[model samples]
Structure formats: structure tokens, C-alpha cells
Target chain A: DVKVTQSSRYLVKRTGEKVFLECVQDMDHENMFWYRQDPGLGLRLIYFSYDVKMKEKGDIPEGYSVSREKKERFSLILESASTNQTSMYLCASRLAGVGELFFGEGSRLTVL
Target chain B: EDQVTQSPEALRLQEGESSSLNCSYTVSGLRGLFWYRQDPGKGPEFLFTLYSAGEEKEKERLKATLTKKESFLHITAPKPEDSATYLCAVQAGGDTGRRALTFGSGTRLQVQP
Candidate 1:
């Protein structure tokens, strides 16, 4: 089974703080994605990386950025956290050309 | 633009009850449709994938069926342990080479003992 690990399960930060969420996949998948799941909105893509140092904007990428310096790791950075950014964040990985995704346990962020 | 919608935002069933969840989609072209089970505070767990119409897949008490524009996940004799949110997503095909999926809001199921 593929293992996708998130650096944190729960986090709380004050408003205007910078936050970093890290994710690592052990299967060497070429595609990694970050999504925020909220009630009544499902999961909305924030960012996705297909290769090292390559990234693309998803539907809702306004306040977020991503780093993919290595093949097996993808990180999401919130430059300035706000109350609206409080939600459950998920990281998923998949092989190129495959639609199936292996997801991490998820990181829940609370900005107060 | 690709879109996915799931019916019955929430469902309540008895331990021995059987029911089905619906997923409707509209995409320029369809590559695959996927079903996932998500527990509270956890990421989704992949369940089944339907590549084309008339495709079906089963695992334990859950069976998934797909058509041209919709998919169904049938849970037979669900148990209390089966309570979770079921999510559906679609990947577009054709010139859109992107592999990212568009997901529905999901159907939350709770089976009472």
C-alpha cells in the first residue's frame, strides 16, 4: 500500500501568522495535490505539482502557494493565515496518467 | 468546465437497511469516476473506480455502478461501522491532459444500530 504522510494532524495559529503544511509520499508518485475540505463545499484543489519545482494553480489558489523541491515531497505554505483559512487540509499523490489517488491522514488547521 | 454533484446530502439507515447513493457529473469528456470513503477528520480512502459506462465494481458490502452521466454506490445491509461520508469525483479526458479530479460535496451516511 502507498503511504502518504502529513507533517501535522492538528495545528492552531494566530491571525497573520505564516503556516507551512508538509506532505511526503513514499510511492514516488509523480503527481501531488493539496485540497481544502469544508462543509457543503467538498474538497477544493488549492495546488498541484507534477514534478520537482513545477506547480499549477487550481480553482481556488488565491491565498496559497506550494513547493515541490523534491519528487517525493510537496509542501503548502500559507503566507498569512486568516480565520477563513481554518479548515481540514488534505494531501494526495498519484502516478502520472492514473486518476486514483492515495491520500494522507490530513491536517486540520485553525486560525484564530 | 467539469462538475460533479451528489444527491441526498445526508442519510440515516438502520443496521440492516440497504440503499444507494447517487453521483451525477457533467464533463467535456470522461476519463474515470472514483468513489471514496471519508471518516471525520481523516482524508478520503479510495474505494472504487469506474472507467466507462456499464462498468461495475464491488467490495464487501458496497457495489458501485456507472452510466454515461451518473454513478451509484449501493450499500447492502450496512452496519454501524459503515457510517461515513462517501465522496464522488470525475477526471476529464480529451485534450485536457490534467489528471486533477473534480469532486462532489459528498453524501454523509449514518447507520443506527
Candidate 2:
């Protein structure tokens, strides 16, 4: 079984503060992703990394950025936290080009 | 581009009552469709994956059926522990190496004991 671990299960940040959500996958998967889930919006991809040092923006990537310096770790960075950015963030990993995604427990952010 | 839409924003069922959820999708070409169960404040857990039309997969009390443009998740003899938000996602053949799954809003099922 594949395991994806997220650093923070919950976080509260003030407006304009920066936030970093970290994720690590045990399996040697080449694809990793960050997504934010909202009540009516579903899971919208924020950023995805195909491999180390490579990244692609998803549908709603305006306020976020990502880093994949190594094969097993991917990080999501919020340049400036805002109330609108408060939501459950999920990290997922999969083998390159195929297979089901293994997800982390998710990081819930609350920005005030 | 690929798109997915799940019907019935919410559902309430009594124990032993059976129900089904619908997922409608449109994509240039279909690769695979996935079903996931999500609990409140938690990430989605994989349930089943269907590759083509007429394909079916079962687990415990849940069954998932897939077609070219739609998929159905049928719950039989539900229990209270089965309550959760069921999410549907799809991978498009035309996506090439992107490997991104487009997800729907999900159906929240509440099974009462």
C-alpha cells in the first residue's frame, strides 16, 4: 500500500501571512499534486509535478505555487494567506502516466 | 478538456434501503473513471475504478458501473457507517501524459440506522 503523509492536519494563519503545506509519499511515484476542496466547487487542482523540478498549473492555481525538489516530497506554498484561501488541501501521488492516486489525509487551513 | 458532474447533492437512506448515485461526464476520449468515499474533514479514499462501458466492480455493499458517458454507484442494504460524500472522477485518453483526474462536486449520502 502507498502512503502519503501531510505535515499539518490543520493550520490557522492571519491574513497576509505565508503558509506552507508539505507532503511526502512513500512509494516512488513520479506524479504528485495539490488540490483544494471547497463546499460547492469540488476538488480543483492547484499544481502538479511530473518529476523533480518540474511543475504545471491546474485549473485554479492563481494564489498558489508548488515545489518538488525531490522525488518523494512536494510542497504547496501560499504566498499570502487570505480568508478566501481557507479550505481543505489534499496531496496525492501516482505513478507516471497511470494508476490510481494515493492521497494524504489533507490539511485544513483557516485564514483570518 | 474533461468534465464530470455528479447528481443529487445529498441523499438520506434508512438502513437496508438501496440507492444509486449518478455521475455524468464528457471528454475527448475516456481512459478510466474512479469512485471515492470521503468522510468529513478527511481526504477521499479510493473505492473503485472502471475502465470501459458495461464494466462493474463491487466492494462490500457498494457497486460501481461505468459506461461511455456516465457511471453509477449503487449502494445495497446500506448501514449507518456508510454515510459519507461519494466523489467521481475521470481520466481522459486525450490527456496524454498529463495524468490529471477531473472530479465532480460529489454526492453526500447519509444512511440512518
Candidate 3:
């Protein structure tokens, strides 16, 4: 079974502070994704990484960035956290071209 | 744009009752369609994947069938533990390396004893 792990399950940060969310996958998948889930809005992609050091912006990428320094780890960074950024963040990984994805437990971020 | 939509935003059923959930999609080209189950405050757990129109997959009490434009998940004699939000996603024709998945709003199921 594929296992995806997120560094934190819940986090609280003050406005204007930088925040980091870490994700790791044991399956060595080539694709990693970051998504924020909200009520009525569902899951919206924030950023994705296809390979080490390669990243692409998804539908909503403002105020957020990603890092893929290694194949098994992907990180989401918030340049300046704001109250609007408070939401449940999910990380997923999968083999390139494969339709199935393994997801992490998710990080619920609260930006006060 | 590739889009996925799920019907019946919420469902309630008595134990031993059976029902189906619907997922409709529109994409340039279909690569795959996936089903997942999510519990409260947790990530989604993968259930099944259907690739072609006539394909079908089954796991225990749940069965999934795909047509040209839609997919249906049938739960037979559901139990209380079977209650959860069912999500559907589609992988459309684009960059294969990207592995992007477009998901629906999901259908929340509730089963009572």
C-alpha cells in the first residue's frame, strides 16, 4: 500500500508569518500535488511537482509555492500567511501517468 | 476545460438498503475515472479505477460501472460503517507527466441502523 505522510495535522500561525507544510510519500511516485479543500469549493489545486526541482502552478497559486528537493518529499510554503489562507491542505502522490493517487492525512491550517 | 460533477449532494438510507451514486464528466479525452471514500477529518481512500466505457470493478459490497459520459457506484445492502463521502475524479488528456486529477464536490452518504 502507498503511504503519504504530512508533517502536521493542524497548525496555527499569525498573519504575515511564513508557514511550511511538509509531505512525504513512501511509494517514490514521480508526481506530487498540493490542494486546499473548502466547503462548496471542493478541492482546488495549489501547486504540483512532477520531478525534483520542477514545479508548476495549479488553478490557485497565489501566496503559495512548492519545493521538491527530493523524490519522496514535497513541501508547500506560504510566503505571507493571511486569515484567508486558513483551510484544510492535502498532499497527494502518484506514479506518472497513473490515475490513482495516494493522499496524506491533511493539514488544517489556521491563519489568525 | 475538463470538468467532473457528482449528483445527490447527500443521501440517507436505512440499513440493508441499496442505492447508487452518480458521477458525470466532460473532458477532451478520458484517461481514467476514479472513486474514493473519505471519512471525516481524514484524507480520501482510493476505491476503484475505471478506464473505458464498458468497464466495471467491484470490491466487497461496492460496485462501480462506467459509461461514455458517466459512472455509477452501487452500494448493496449498505451498513452504518459504509457511510462516508464518495468522491469521483477524472484524468483527462493533457500532459501525462503532470498526473493532474479533476475532482467533483462528492456525495455524502449516511446509513442508519
Docking level of model 2: medium
RMSD of each: 1.0, 1.0, 1.1
For candidate 3, give the lDDT.
Answer: 0.93
Give all TM-scores, in the order shown. 0.98, 0.97, 0.97
lDDT by residue for model 1 (A1-112), tens: 9999999999999999999999999998999999999999999999898888989889899889999999999999999999999999999999886579889999999999
Question: How many residue pairs clash per model?
Answer: 0, 0, 0
As for DockQ, the candidate ahead, 2 or 3, is 2
Docking class of 3: medium
Q: Per the 3 Å backbone cut-off, how many clashing residue pairs does candidate 2 have?
A: 0
iRMSD for each candidate structure, in the order shown: 1.2, 1.1, 1.4
Model 1, range B36-113, lDDT digits (tens) per residue? 999998899999999999999999999999999999999999999999999999999864246788899999999999
lDDT-wise, the better of 1 and 3 is: 1
Model 1's A-chain: what TM-score? 0.98
How do the candidates score on chain B by TM-score?
0.97, 0.96, 0.96
Clashing residue pairs found in predicted model 1: none
DockQ of 2: 0.72
lDDT (tens digit, per residue) of candidate 3 on A1-104: 89999999999999999999999999879899999998777788899888889888888999998999999999999999999999999999998766688899
Q: Candidate 1 or 2, higher TM-score?
A: 1
Tens-digit lDDT track of model 3 for B9-87: 9999999999999999998779899999999999999999999999999999999999999999999999999999999
